[model samples]
Target: MVRVLLVDDEELVRVALTAILDSAAGIEAVACDGPEAVGLARSTAPDVVLLDVNMPGADGFSVLRELRALPEPPAVAMLTLLGSDEYLHAALRFGACGYLLKDTEPHLLIDCVRILAGGGVVYVPPQSRAVMGTHVNVPLPAPAAPELRGRVTGREYEVLALLAAGLSNTEMAERLGVGMTTVKTHIGALKKKLGAPSRVALAAVAHREGLLDTASADRP
Candidate 1:
C-alpha cells in the first residue's frame, strides 16, 4: 500500500482529499496543516505527499523544501487551484514530483499519486507544460547528433525521445513494446548519462541539446 500525506490549511479540503484517498484501494492517507507538515512527514514517512500550494503560514514552497531535506523524503505533488506558471516552476525547482490541478477528477488524482509513488513523475492536463513552454512549436534546425556529454545507447536515445514527449513510464513501456521495468532501466540510464537530477530536468536537457528536434524529425 502507498502511504500518502495530505497537507492543506483548509480543514474541509483536507477532509475531502483524505476521504477520497482512503477509499481507494492500496492507499492510506493522513492529513496535517502546513505548519505540521514537515514534522508529520518525518514521522509517518509517507511514500507521497499531496501538498496544497496556498497555505496560511509557511506556504507550500517552504513546506516542500523542508520535506525534501529529510533523510528519506517522500515524493511531493503540488495541488493547487491556480495554474500560474510561477507556482508550477517554483514547485519543480523545489523538487516536486508532480503538479496537479485541484479540480482534477478523483480517479486521475489517485492515479497521479500511484504514479509518483511508483517513482514516476506527473504533470497533468497538458496545459501545465505552459510553465516551461515545453510543447511550444518552433522551427527546427537541421538534424545533428544530440550532444550527449556521456555515451548513451541507441535504445536509450529512443527512450529519451519519448520522455521528452512527456510520456510516463507506463506509456513509454507501451510505446517501446517492453516491460515497465525495462522502461525504468532506460530512464535510469538516461539520467546517469545526462546527469539530470529529475525527470523534468532530463526533459529540459533534451530540449537544450536539440534531442527533441532530432527525435521529431526522425519520427515518420
Candidate 2:
C-alpha cells in the first residue's frame, strides 16, 4: 500500500482528498492540517505527501523543501488551485515530485499519485515549451555527439514513446514484448542519454527535441 500524508488548511479540502485516496485501493491517506504536516510526515514517514499550496504559516513550498531535506523524503505532490507556471516551476525546483490542480479528475489524480510514488515526475497540465516567453532549448551536456540522438535504439525509442505516453514499466514491457528488467534498463539508459532529471524531464526534453514528432523522426 502507498502511504500518503495529506496537508491542507481547509477541512473540506482535506476531507475530499482523503475520500479520493481512501477509495483508491493500495493507498492509505493520512490527513492533517497545515501546521501539523511536517510533524505528521516525519512521524508517519509516508511514501508520498499531497500538500496544499496555500496554507497557514508555512506554505506548500516550505513543506516541500523540508520534506526533501529529510533522510528518506516522501515524494511530494503540490495541490493547488493556481495554474501559474511560476508556481509550477517553483514547486518542481523546490523538489516537488508533482503539481496537481485541485479540480483534476479524481481517477486521474489517483493515477498521478501512483505515478509519482513510482518515481515519475508529474507537472501541471499543458506542457508548455516556453520559459518566460522565450523558447526554452534544452542543450545536451558537454560535447554533443551526433550519435547521442540515435543512442537510444529504435526499440528503445519505442520504449521512450511508451514512457511518454505514461505507461508503467510492466505495461511497457508487456506492450513491447520485452521483460520488465529490459524496460528498466532502457529507461535508465534513456535518462543518462537525455541528461534528464526524471522521467517527466526526459519526456519534456524528448518532446522539445522533436523526438515525439513523428514528422521529424521515423517511428518504427
Candidate 3:
C-alpha cells in the first residue's frame, strides 16, 4: 500500500483530497494543516506527501525543506492553486519530486501519487510544463560567450536538451535509451561544465547560451 500525507491549510481541501486518494486502490491518505504537516509526517511515515504551497505560518516550501530534513523523508509533491515559473523553480530547487495544481482532475491526481510513490517525478498537466518552458526560454544573461561552445559531450548535450524540456532523470533515461546512472553522470558532468547549481539552473543556462538551439541543429 502507498501511504500519503496530504497537507493543506484549508480543511475542505484536505478533506476532499483525502477522499479522492482513499478511493483509489492500493493507496491510503491522511491529512493535516500545513503547521502540523512536519509532525504528522514523522509520526505517520507516509510514502509520499502532498503539500500545499500556501499556508499560514509554514508555507509549502518551508515545510518541504523541513520534511526533507527528516531521517527518512517521504517523496514530496507541491500542491498549489496557482501555477507559475517561480513556484516551479523554487519547488525543484527545494527537492520537490512533483509540482501539481490543486484543481487537477481526481483520477490524474491519484495517478500522480502513484507515480511519485513508485519513484517517479511528476511536473505535468501541460500548464506547468508551459510555464516551465516560458521561464527557461527567457532571455536571461548567459554565462561567458566562449564558455558555451563544445563544453559538453554529444550525449551530454542531448541530456541537457531534455532537461530544458522538463524531462526527469527517469524520463530522460527512457528517451535516450540509456541507464539512469548514465543519465545522472551526464547531468553531473553538464552541471560542472555549465557551472549550474541545479537541474533547473542548468536548463536556464542552456537556454541563455543558445545550447539547446545549437543541439537541435546538430541532431539528425
Which candidate achieves the best lDDT against the true structure? 3
Residue pairs that clash (backbone atoms under 3 angstroms), model 1: none
Clashes (N, CA, C under 3 Å) per candidate: 0, 0, 0
Model 3 C-alpha RMSD to native: 4.5
Pick the TM-score winner: 1
Candidates, ranked, lDDT: 3, 1, 2
Candidates 1 and 2 compared by lDDT, better number? 1
> Higher-lDDT candidate among 2 and 3?
3
Q: Write the per-residue lDDT of candidate 1 for residues 29-93, one digit (tens) a residue.
A: 99999999999998899999999998888689989988888887888989989878778778777
Candidate 3: C-alpha lDDT: 0.82
Give per-model TM-scores.
0.76, 0.67, 0.66
lDDT (10s digit) by residue, model 2, range 1-220: 9899989998999898999999999998989987898889889999889888889887788888778778777878888888787786676556576788899999998998898776565665574224312212444342243455657677767877887776777678888898978987898788788776456556666766666664236653
Off by over 4 Å in 2: 33-47, 65-75, 92-97, 105-108, 115-147, 150-155, 179-182, 209-220
Please give the distance, in angstroms, between residue 118's alpha carbon in candidate 1 and its true position after superposition: 4.0
Expressed as tens digits, the lDDT of each residue in 14-112 for candidate 3 is: 899999999999999999998899999999999999999988988789999899889877889999887777788778777687898998999999988
